[model samples]
Target: ASPQSGYTLAVLNVGAPAAGMNAAVRSTVRIGLIHGHRMLAVHDGFEGLAYGKVRPPGIKGGETPQEVEGTPRCRGHPPRGIFHPPRTLPKKYFEEISTNISNFGIHGLIIIGGFEAFTGSLELMEGRAKYEELCIPLCVIPATVSNNVPGSDFSIGADTALNTITTTCDRIKQSAAGTKRRVFIIETMGGFCGYLATMAGLAAGADAAYIYEEHFNIHDLQ
Candidate 1:
């Protein structure tokens, strides 16, 4: 069935947390609500849905998604994460998450994260038969420091995380400069994408980077 009016949507994080995850969650929630959809924040990535409940660490619960701020507003420091512990649901609710289409009136899911999010969304999309009575719309926003998600070159936190890597490298480089013949090998997280390592190396003026995009060659560094 097609999605009807006022469809309830759930927002999920699919992988490792990064700088702008909270912002994405906040934005999706606010905008989804403005579009007349009911929004439910699914905490702790897929685990939350699998486990049925999670503690919303820094997030305030009682506030509806419509009330969330869509605009970027800095309130001192942004929250590190939105997960804590102890928010419980009925046992074996993961089964319900997969099959109970109309249980919470959830007909839409907006996932934010990297390849994991993309893959998971596809599985859910493929499993549409499980919820034959509802039109479950699934969308994913790439959000990883890896920036490895195929559709977009720039993921949600990629830019910010790259900047951080460069900034940290700059500080470390400064320290390395004070010492004689000391080279610092800074590591970054990008699995196989290497976007972070390549860009951060360039941004920080590093001598070279061992990235997956190119063959490993010590001569390249030389």
Candidate 2:
């Protein structure tokens, strides 16, 4: 569509912060702009959307896509408890978000973050029947170190997290090898999924790694 008749698209970051989030947001905004759409960003995720915290892409006045993409951390994230699974939020919450969508003239939404991002998109999709403003198209981009989002083999930040863990573990092993016999129990974050710990164990040559997905006992550890 022509720029004059282009749709308005907004992007939101939900759930916990993760590496590579800024790059994802930058790509979304740039892609939308390239397609002649009016691209806006919703700060603070759904809470921001409910409160009309919509604005043009950068956080600072002089920021550009190049700066945004080069950043190492996420720009922002919704606070915990601000979002729940689909159909679990109160009716008024949906109403407030819908009001902001109408006010912003948003035609589509792109959510970037972890599992919460997925659930938030689902909630918006299911709310379409009750709120016309929510009928707009939605997209979810997985951007968590956890790598726990279902159906996605890999999340945006998972690789970076794994590499960091492997490097650190290598350093730790080197140190241990030079000293008296000692053992270390390392923990990696992956929410309920064991992907990080499991994969990192294989990559780092850990004696054993545990994840929430698997059940174990004292004998198993022994």
Candidate 3:
């Protein structure tokens, strides 16, 4: 018997924040919706998935109160509720998330994050298989300052971190006096490749920059 075709897949981004995190989410949602797939966003990191922090639109509302103290008499509006994800994610949160997805019939997942976060995705994939339930397709999007993920020229947050470093270095150079000898070491997040470190160092006129891609001999400085 031929297998029945499943519904179009939805994406779930499970990772840390980069400058373009929201942009990626928006794009994914738009594309998925265009293709007739239901879009769902997973809050926080993998912990969000594990603890069942999955939310849909209209689930919560805004923080500001609808009625103001000094408000004038205009048209009356309904009170809007505030949206909040689950608090106190526990170590075994993934188990809970997996159970929830299984029960709720979730079919697709998209994970976005650094190397550590990818590990969580792997775990979730394995969980999906072990339960003998419907298998969900998982996609991973790299988003780390380290730029260590192979096969990709750019990660999500690298550009933003690089810009911040350049600005800070420029300020330091302007404040230095001719008579004063100043040494500054600016450390940014790059677990492996050091792409952000190298770019920022060069743009900021750093004398030397060290990265995982190329080795730096400490004895040369001596």
Candidate 4:
């Protein structure tokens, strides 16, 4: 179901930030708000949740100057910035979060990360029964550079990685042309799947592209 179906969705990003982290957070928040549910952020991933680093925004009372209409007591006052202490998760952070899910009135969660991130997600999902008793749902969105997620065309970072590689390759091609270089060998990360390398090569107009998805013969390029 879409986020705007009146479900309180919490987004827990378990890995390092990338180009689209903020976008994902913003989108999730916007949709959740539209759906008529309060949104909470779990910072620093499972570590944050485990350590009780969840933060929710709310108004705190601040001193304001008043203006007097007919008397001094009626005078207007300027507003001042309010301070709110960060709420650290409880000592039994995970257990507390699970039990208090109903108390806090949360509806769902969106987890974003790579394969390793699934470990925490799986933990949460496996514990869904306990959470569901309190009315909480969990969802996951894969967003790693590995592009190893099954049955998906691309992860969140795939496009950015491809663009970076293509730009770098363009610069290298210019230098190669200037220096009269005959060959250029570019190695990229991705142990079992070379989606990034292949896409970048094709987009950057490489002489040939090598990917783990297909067999390569050295003599074919020679």
Query: Which candidate number has the best TM-score?
Result: 2
Writing each residue's lDDT as its tens digit, candidate 1 over 1-222 gives: 223356777776666666787788788876665576666766555556654432222334544543465322222334544432222322334455664445556677777777877776666555556545334677888878898888786888788898888889988988898899666888898988888888888889988789887778766655
| Model 3 misplaced stretches (Cα beyond 4 Å) | 1-15, 58-95, 177-179, 212-222
Per residue, candidate 2 scores C-alpha lDDT tens digits across 1-222 of 335446998887787767777768778876766567788877667877787778887534444433333111222433432332121222457999998989989999888888888877777778889999898988888988999887788889899999999999999998888888577878888878899999999999999998898987768765
Off by over 4 Å in 2: 59-92
lDDT score, candidate 3: 0.57
Model 1: lDDT equals: 0.65
| Model 3: worst 10 consecutive residues (lDDT sum) | 66-75
lDDT of 4 by residue, 1-222 (tens): 224454555666655334464456566665555555666766555555554555553223421112101100001212222111122222334676665455545677677665545555556656656545323556666666667666566777777877888888888888898776378888876667888888788898887888888888888668
Q: TM-scores of the models, in the given order?
A: 0.75, 0.83, 0.69, 0.67
C-alpha lDDT values of all predictions:
0.65, 0.76, 0.57, 0.58
lDDT tens digits, residues 1-222, model 3? 223334544344443445665556556654555455555555544555555556542212432212111100111222322222122222355567767677556787766656655666566556555554425677767766666656567788787888888898888788764447666667767767677887888898888887777776767544
Q: Residue 99 deviation, candidate 2, in Å?
A: 0.7
Candidate 4 or 1, higher TM-score: 1
Q: Candidate 4: where is the Cα deviation over 4 Å?
A: 1-7, 57-105, 128-135, 180-182, 212-222
Best by lDDT: 2
Judge candidate 4 at residue 23 and give its lDDT: 56
